[model samples]
Target chain A: MNSQDAILPIAIPLAGAGVAMLLRGWPKAQRLWTFGILMASLAMCANLLNHVFSSGKPLVFQLGGWAAPFGISIVVDALSAIMIVMVQFVMLMGCIYALDAKDIAKRYSVFMPLFLTLTVGLTGVMLTGDTFNLFVFMELIVISAAALTAMSDDRSGTEAAFKYFYISQLATIFLLLANGLIYMSYGTLNMADLAIRIKTDALAGGPMPPMFTLAMVCFFATFMIKCAAFPFHFWQPDFHAAAPTAVSAMLSSVVVKSGVYGFIRMTTLLFEPFAPQLQQVLMLIGAIGVIYGGFSAFGTHHAKRMFAYSTLAQIGFMLMGIGWGGTLGIAAAIVFMVNHALIKSAMLMLSGYLASKAQIKSASFENIKGLGKYLPQSGVLFFIGSMALAGLPPLNGFVSKMMVFRAGIEAEQWAWLAAIGLASLLTLIYTMRAFQWVWFVPPAAGVKAKKDGDSLFAPTMLILACVVLGIWGESLVSIAMQASEWVQQPAAYIAAVNPAK
Target chain B: MDIIISFAIAVLFATGIYQLLRRNVVRSALGLVIISNAINLFLLAIGAYDGTVQSYAKAIGVRSDALPLALILTAIVISMGGFAFTFAMLYIVMRRYKTADIDAITELKN
Candidate 1:
């Protein structure tokens, strides 16, 4: 594959969004166009992953034929390639699910364009090798996501979008400020260049500049907010619950992973010198998030809100894995992220299906009560998703959770290990509570299930993915292990991006 | 000049945050705009300010660092787009709720 193939994942969706907007009058054509574009992007990403794994090198494409430090570079290493593939796959599934959703289809004209734009942003975030470029793509994500959130059928959707917009804007501003400070201190926006400078500076035993530490703090705050870790998690539950189900699925799955991606990049590449200190902070926050998110999820009565809290809990686990900060820990974190994306998104979509079958189109416990009997396929799918999420054996979540537990044990983090175990118990409780309430519980008096002819293909396909990955867990675990190794050692990454050096 | 710019940035940040904490949604939105501008100014202040030669000119003497300016411009454009959408959303929210008070618009909860 050509080095320029790095840009195809981003470029395809971007150009497709414009073409889709033009085909707005023809919804079928627009859907086909968007799907084709996503498929093409996915193909490119898979090809990139194949190329990176086979070549054993990161692919770096410097725009305008300029060298890395002077120009914008698109770098696709194992980690980026894996992230791109995971995101594109989840996006494709969510797109398929959206097709069968009538409420979403009603706003298809606007939804398709925004959805494609969102793909463009996400792909860009995954591909960009520069910090400023990351900030720009993140803004693209925020704009499209906020717009899509506003399009939700829920009455609170607009309000949720409003809250999401302002908070995200504030977060990105911190990112921008951090970028400026980084440039001012190191005289480079290129991450590879920054890493080299920081490494050399730390090696020289010079006093670390206060400004750089402040910048690091800012970067940390921005990503923490983006991932919705404990204290910064207020905006997430409201936003996720009120978003249209398909959008909610995407937000919970891929969008938030961007934050995790940023954190990984920071610890593994940009700020390796500071990793020891940062890892401690991350572990503390992760423990709190695990406990807080788990209990909150159990406390919530609304199905989507409960799932949103569950997302918080899941992210907490990933954060813990990342905080463990070794080849084992990072690999475990990556696995957890991938598995949770599939499990949570599928569960969210299944809840959406349940909501669609209700008299009132809401996923509230009362509205969706006993509605699962009407859709046995969704009931089964939800069961699989819940089991996967609760870390049952023979499922993807079990493999990832086991990896995390092993890593904690290896690190001898007993307190965090206990927290993870407690949260796992809570996960089982809330997930089972939701499942029984929706699928097995008897309907309330005078509440009848709507007999809609929605297809169960999308969520079912996603659950099948969880099952397959769980059973065939070795391949993904190996791949994640490889990605984590590459992340831990930034030498190959720096060399690839700055070949001239 | 650096001191003055830093002071201005600080003041702008304080004012923006003050507005942001207001109960009124419109004020909060405006506050976000102010904070964004403050950040932009902060970016400008961080760039090399000693150069007499313009960045576009090729000179033996020190040329001004143009990257931060470019970054600020990008930040401005992005913030503008976000603010436009935020204001529009705020308008829709205000219309639906019949009040701009954030406390009054409490449909979504734990």
Candidate 2:
């Protein structure tokens, strides 16, 4: 649990990606190499999580042997550790599931390279302790995502990529504006350093300049848009629906969490002092996201599009949960992140598989039907995913959703509670309709159902994971509580990154 | 000088947003280019450039901070890559769809 261990998560995938680029002519070799790299990385993530949990402290790694505040550091507390493990886990599953998604894998020789780079960027965002570095990582993510979105052969893929590119650039512009203001005020870009300086400056009886609040507002708005929250969420649906199925899985499941990760990290590191006031705002945004995403999703018919909107609704729930503003709220948000990442990746991959095997190569329930009889096991797994998404009882989603409800109640936000309740009902209705369309109905006139081999492994593992999270909910809850505590109180975080201090 | 530069940055930003809201993909891409330049200018302004110093003096007291210059250099390189990528896509989109308007690229719409 030290700085050296911190680099492993980023390095493995990056090196693998470089090697993958070299092996571009041989798809088989490329796939094998990337899979091995991801598995090794997953194991390393597990080891890091175990080590951190046992040590019960944060791991700090300063680059090039420099002092923390003087140099960039990678800090992994419980929260970061869990997110790392979760991100790596989903990515590993995605790699396996994507073997059959040949349209994307075979088309772009740089696909795996870009995929590894995306993972590196995500890990960087989660683990880095510098604001400017966060900007750099955000750029990496945007560039890779835009390229991947455009990699698909469909004409609309280019358009979707462009749309996402411009919108995300707007968000990045706001982020840079905030970072410039912060550097101007504090003369430091290290997050922990800023936290300490801001606090000490406040304690010396100098109220923060109004400019600081404006900078934080910039960070807030940018991260909210990145989260694809209610008002600025229009960019995600097209990108998610149009990307190749494997990329769609990654975009819907793991990529969007970078925004949530940034919001949580920035809040814990920079805005804990303003949590009480900010909590209400967070709840309000979360609630709006829930209802709007829910009702809108209810009207969507295409399978991937439906899932994309559902993801919107799910993020809304996550925001409301975290906005409740305490150990429970933060823990619930963390749980929601983990659960959504698992279920959505599986669901997207499954839909991709079904649609690819069908005659029409589309995910509209209109194009393919009776998927249940052709792939009964997949149908059951899909049902599990839908049920979990809708927060059906005795499932993983239920546990997190219930925690969110309890957290909302504790915060005494009856309106948030009511909105969330209605959102949940909307989710159930749409999800069930989706389930009926895919699994229960007779085959579409021209549809043909063929099950593919080894494609089921990833979804099965992910669905099993959902079950484990439910049956073993206590462990997740306890870990989430500990993680939330570590996040809420940033003293250890600051100290770990700047141990010499 | 600072006031002038700030005013110009504001104008650049205004123009960028206007272009970004255009219906044509090519124009929107042009908007992105303008906005990126404005962003670089804002970063430079935040560094509080000291114009009195001679540009070639290596050991001057009034020189501006070098960090924003480095940052702008990096930002320029990165944005060039991004813009190049977007423009290539724009070309492909134009050739494939025979139009530059995003509204007409509706094959994926529900």
Candidate 3:
């Protein structure tokens, strides 16, 4: 495939968002247009992934024909390609579920356009090879996602949106400061160029400026807040809980992955010399997130809130895997990231579906108690999703979790391993407890189920993916290995971006 | 010049943080705006001023970098959009709750 094709995934959604906005007068046309755009982008991503893997090189597109280190470069390596495909796939599912959920469709005329814009932002974030471009794309994501969250039917949605918007701005400000610091010291905003400069400087035995470490700290704090790790996770549960069901699924599944992506890019590409040290810190913070998120999730009674806390815990698991800091460890983290994205999105959508069927249209246990009995299909789906989330056998979560466990063992990180084990036990306890309460508990008096006609196709498709990936997980593991190897050795990525060097 | 710019940035940051910690939602929003401006100034300072030449005119002598100007402009635009959205949301929130106090806006809980 041509290197120019790399921009299609980002450009298509962006242009399509404009078109979707115009078609807003016709909801039917808007839905079709949005769906068509997502499918086209997904195809483009798949094609790009195939090209990158087959050629064994990153696909680099220099914007406006300007060379790297001077102009914007859009690079699609194996890791970025994998992440793009996963995110677009999840977005497509969320769109499908949103279309089927009548309340959202009826209330929000701008949903389709906003959703398309969000995809554009996400794809741009995944593709951009420049730090400044990453910041720009991140802003795009924050704006669209905050708007989507504000459009939730719940009155609390606006409050959640405000909180999300304000906190995200704070994070981005830190990011901007970090970017400025990097540019000041290295004289380049292009990631590949910065990587080369840092490497060369280290080889020359030069002392790094203290500003560099401060920049790293800023980067660390920005991503941790974005990732909703411990101590910075206060905004997540309320934000996720207040968002619309499909939006909630998207937020928990792929949106938060942007933070994880930043960490990966930082540790793997920008600050390679500092990785070993950062990995230890990441492990410590991740372990704390695991315990805190798990216990908080168990303590919560709201369905969406519980899942949000669980998201914190799952992100912690991926962080610990990343902290293991070898080819195997990064691969396991990739596996876990992909698996958790699918399983968590499915669980969120299922919860949304059940909430839609309830009289009060809330995911709180009090409103949704015994509601699953009326929707046995969703009940089965939720069971599979929960089991998968808890890393049960014959599910994708189990395979990824096993990989993470293996990575920890190989790394000989016994203390972190114990933390992971305890977190796993906690995950099991919380998920099963929520499962029992929702599916088995008797309905409290005066709680009645509504005759909602929302389709279960979205969550079902995701759950089916979980089962399929679980059964045939070797392929995913191999792909994760390939991606991780590309990540570990940045030479190819740097060369692809700056061929002249 | 470096000391002056650093002092300015420090002062702006302190004021921004103070406003940000206020109980009033509007003040906090304005705090964000102030902080963003401070960051923009910091970006400018990081470029290390060279007043010998203009950005538009490139001479054989020392030329000042224009990239920081571009970066600051971008930051200004983004922060402006963010503030506009934040104010609009605050207006809605205020109208709904009839208060600008953040502590009173407690609709969402665990």
Q: Which parts of model 3 are misplaced by more than 4 Å? A: B48-60
lDDT of 1 by residue, A1-501 (tens): 899888999989899899999999998888888888888889988999999999999999999988999899999999999999999999999888888787753465889888988988988888899999999999999999999998888888999999998899999999999998898788899999899999999999989766899999999999998888889999999999899888999999999999889889999999999899999988988888888999999898789899998888888888899999899999999999889899988988888878888888888897888877667777778888999999999999999999999999999999889877987899999989988988798777877777674467888899999999999999999999999999999999999999776
Predicted candidate 3 versus true structure: per-residue lDDT over A65-106, tens digit per residue: 999998999999999999999999999999898888966534
Q: What residue pairs clash in candidate 1, if any at all?
A: none
Model 1 residue A170 distance off true place after TM-score fit, in angstroms: 0.4
Q: In model 1, where do residues sit more than 4 Å from their true spots?
A: B54-62
lDDT accuracy of residue A492 in candidate 1: 94
If scored against the real structure, what TM-score would every candidate get? 0.98, 0.95, 0.98
Chain B in candidate 2 has what TM-score? 0.87
User: What is residue A387's positional error in candidate 1, in angstroms?
Assistant: 0.7
All models, DockQ values?
Answer: 0.87, 0.62, 0.82
**CA lDDT, every model vs. true structure:** 0.89, 0.83, 0.90
Interface RMSD of each: 0.8, 1.4, 0.8
Q: Distance from true position, residue A458, model 3, in Å?
A: 0.3
